[model samples]
Target: SWLLQVGPEGYIVLPSAGTLEVAGRTLADVRLDVLHRLSALFRGVNIDVRLGRPRTFRIYLTGQVKAPGALQVTGSPRVSDILNSAALQDNASRRHIQVVHPDGSRELTDVERFVRIGDQSMNPWLRDGDVLQVPVANEFVWAEGAFGRPGQIELGLNDSLLTLFRLAGDPLPAAEVGNVLMLHWKDPFKPDSTWLRLDDVYRGTTNPPLRDGDRIYVYYIPQYHLQHEATVVGEVERPGTYPIAEGRNRISDLVKAAHGFLPTADLTSIRVHRLNPGAGEKDPELDRLLRLSRDQLTASEYVKLTTKLSSLREDYRIDWARLQESPKDLDLLLKDGDVVRVERLVPSIRIDGEVRHPGILTFQRGLRIQDYVQQAGGFTDRAWASRIRVTRVVTGQTLPARNVRALDPGDFVWIPERPDKTAWDDSREILTALAQVATVLIAIKSVK
Candidate 1:
């Protein structure tokens, strides 16, 4: 739609509503007036007044603002509405934003206070024909460590440690408020450092006024790095992250702490996944072996490479049954960020490709590859039975028929098929027969 601009003289002229004073008034207040003015003429009508478009006006942007000129702005915008990190000059003071009214009266607003605490008073509505500016900040105090907002903060009038903390969005729970370190730069040459308890500042016991070039460090309380913990998820009674003691706690301890496994939990298939494993640790031999190609590797090197790739990875297959029998030997000792995944029971082996009834068969102990193939209704005519491969679920390794002696419970047997001969293969065979016949005729003629 159409726009009704709020004139500089503090009113919006309408055809029906006449002239309504919109300055210093919300849209709701203006809308109510329109309803009252229209009700006097019409018997009963629905009056829906929506903000079609915001009015535009120019304001003086002087001082330390990046663009210190007359800037055109629309709508009833606040101080922060027109300001961003990029809009300010490098050393511009955000806390001390000066707004000079048309009457030559000044009002100070802290842009950071509004952002940190959401105090509407700190971010006032912009008026037309006002001089807005942010002075070059000469006094700044730095805050670091466990604060919600930690950086260089512009010092303001009557600013204390409380003001600094408030402007910094308060200290984190891990902050050592009992001992806050401050570096005072009273003299340009070197500096004086002191430690003060924040509790004393709150109690009005020791609150010294902060100065320019002062850097305060809010140290985090020790042990904030966290202890060794493991996360147990999926099919567990209580799925969550639980802290563990390195030598004392085992897989069983973690399971007990989690209130044991759920009814659907596959105890046979539970795994302990260590975080990163031996990341950042150097293994020259292993690294060299892993980088080498298959043909470049020796027999011993290939064995080492395969072992490292499979056995030395992040996840470890747990022997939950063996752990129960011999807890001291089989129970895994979990470290920090270790994840214990427990999945639901799946009691069938899958037979795929070149089989008449290629589907899942109920897993049985002491079953071989042939037994699984028999269960899947033998094989199709095109089946390459000799080149069969079995995939073990426990180790997730695909083994050839020669390497794989017997099938495991959760093994997947894949019987591949022979590819059909194309038209090119038939043509090549006929061309070879013709060339052989021509060669024999030439040989016979030479003999004659």
Candidate 2:
């Protein structure tokens, strides 16, 4: 084991060769002496000697590299190796790199050439206490939106749209190559704009020149332009606005685009609400309502008239029955802003009053009042089946149970409780009936 120390003159002192005599020597000389002594001591025997820590030296890595600092590197490291460790920035200039020595001597390293041509001479071994300065290249244009690597890109003197696209890592899939916009600022406030077709540029049909400070914007493809867009809302598997391409633009297409109808969707009635071309046209009926005096009509009547007029002005609704009967009618082209509404299926009918299971039952077609009653475990013992009433949902009219052959969705069936009467109750009922008859005769005489 041999010990080594640095002298005040910045040199290492170690035992000379294999002898005990100490002498100051350069790092290269010390390694050579040790190798010679080791070979002589053991002929044809390879020995692995671990080299101790080398003299600490600092190098400044500034400009266009990540983590610019006074880096401490041991032994002689090549310029390429140092840059690899420091990590070059995206905009770093690899072609015109400079190494400034402590004694003010300068050396140019063409790192780009070394990287491309593998010319080791271009990436010379770095000397201790050297300053590695990377210069930034000039002439750049900004690329924004829908580009893989969008930012400021360096351009050559004769660079064009082709060069810019390549430097920006090309357009993304969502980019609209046919609608790229380029803007050149003439001054701080004035800009000259030009629309470009990158598809044509890429095809070499045109090569538009790009100048410094010019901004290139790649537009994303619009949903409508890429496909005919129609909106489907309510009671569908996935209800939302959908796009239908050239061969796919139809009513069926829109339905498929919406992922089909849900189980709760009303298949019998689908409404297509279209944007009316005459929407801006004034209606004479609405004008008439507007001219009416508010004092002449009650507040409720005025509101009703206004709402009815508004509905008449809106887009017309097409029934789903027409489309269902003729599926080919689905071939009808869907325009932009057209809204297709699939109504939700009506819920079950309600059955209350004296029944074994008095609750709601699922609505089915051609269901009679007795059918619902049967579903509810039949009428209770006290139920007056003859006095049962059926309420219509649309008309809100209560009719006799026997008159209703089938029940509509949302209809209510009610069974009344039977009246229990005694002999005294019969006498009181006869007296009440006579009093009603006497009052009716008196009212008729007064009207006459």
Candidate 3:
């Protein structure tokens, strides 16, 4: 019989054929080192290991082993000793026994199976130099870092090694402290969800759970104020500024604010001028002056002018019958925040009976009879319109009006409704009367 065993003194071997006995400490240490190294090779292989009471187990050794089987171990016997003991009991193949580990790992061994050795039970996954680990039952405490998070930690009965991380990078521009966010997997226990305020986080008051795959997110907040308002000018009772409520600052609103247009307002010829953007003050003023002077530009030209003004302020536009027409027809919308202006056309009387084409005349400062007659389309053929009869409405008096007679804004002149006769008798009489009056005035002036 061949005997294989290791005691306090070391390994002792009894040879199979010869009565030769071998004993040595170095030999035993080397044997143990080899066994441990072999175990490491199978570190992660799955092995059916029964953690029995004290020192017993019904272990299944399989996968990667030539002869896989189940065996009952007892009395602090190592796996190596179990295989060797099985060899002594049956015709077990010594080369078939192997070590298997948790990670589907395995290792082949050629050492004699039937051997009695004492040290400690081998952890097939740990190498000879590797420290053997005993799992110390830990209390279910809050664990953090790479392992457990802040809210729920797993406390070991003794101590443990865990990896951890920290808050990094610069704070984003919009991130608010009150609602700092963590975009992570939803906790199954808290379906309602949870969030942490920045104050709590900064003060370390709240220990929000930060698991392995957790990330923090930051967001921004919104802001609001009053945006825009307008002014009224020209032909109004009380032209001034007023508050512009939302969706209420239109042309009609401006007119209403200004107490409506005055009685002298030219409903058909109303003009609204606005400051033109990209146009210098001098240029816009000059343009307006030119339009006022010419007064006969096409609607297109007027539209262009309005567009120029609109560019400066979107609220400026013509606020009369013209505005009712299309913008192409020189009408435009009044923009909010614009100054509204109304211009009153000059008022004057018309002359007709003996004029070329009795037309309306415009009144100017200090306008005389000759100027008014000339502006009223001049005199007709063989008609003495210049020899006018000025009647006073209040006194009902007729004055012998002359060419240089000064007229008021609403005064009238009768060109003596020409008499229809074969001879020019009445016409001559009217002219002679006017001539006599002119001569008298000249004589009086000469005396003075």
Per-candidate RMSD vs. true structure? Answer: 11.0, 12.9, 31.2
Q: For residues 1-448, could you state the per-residue lDDT of candidate 2 as single tens digits?
A: 6455544354444344334222344546656766676677667877443447655678999999898989998865778878862488877877568999988998877664455436676687777789999878665679999888899865544567887777677888989867888898778688899898888888998777877789999988865335567788888888888865544487777888778888887665566777667667776866776778988777886987878665655343444567777867544677877788887767678999999999889999877788889999998999999999988663457999888877767789999999998999999999999999999999999999
How many pairs in model 2 have backbone atoms within 3 A of each other, for residues 3 or more apart or on separate chains, i.e. clashes? 0
TM-score of each: 0.64, 0.39, 0.24
Stretches > 4 Å off in candidate 2: 1-140, 144-163, 171-182, 186-189, 192-212, 217-322, 326-364, 368-448
lDDT tens readout by residue for model 1, 329-390: 88888787889999787778999999999999998878877888898899999999888888
The prediction achieving the highest lDDT against the true structure is 1
Clashes of each: 0, 0, 22
Clashes of 1: 0
TM-score of model 3 vs. true structure:
0.24
Q: How well is each residue in 1-448 modelled by candidate 3, as lDDT tens digits?
A: 2233433233333232222222322345554544454455556754232213333445564433334565565544444544443333333333333455445465543222122122132313222211111222223323221211233222211211111112122233344557654544467343233565655654557655444334444445442234445677778888887666645455676677778989876454444445555555566653763566337756777777766655665233353765556534443445445676665644665565676666566757687666766776677675765467765331234676853256544456667555566557878888999999999999999999
Which lDDT value does model 2 have at 390?
88
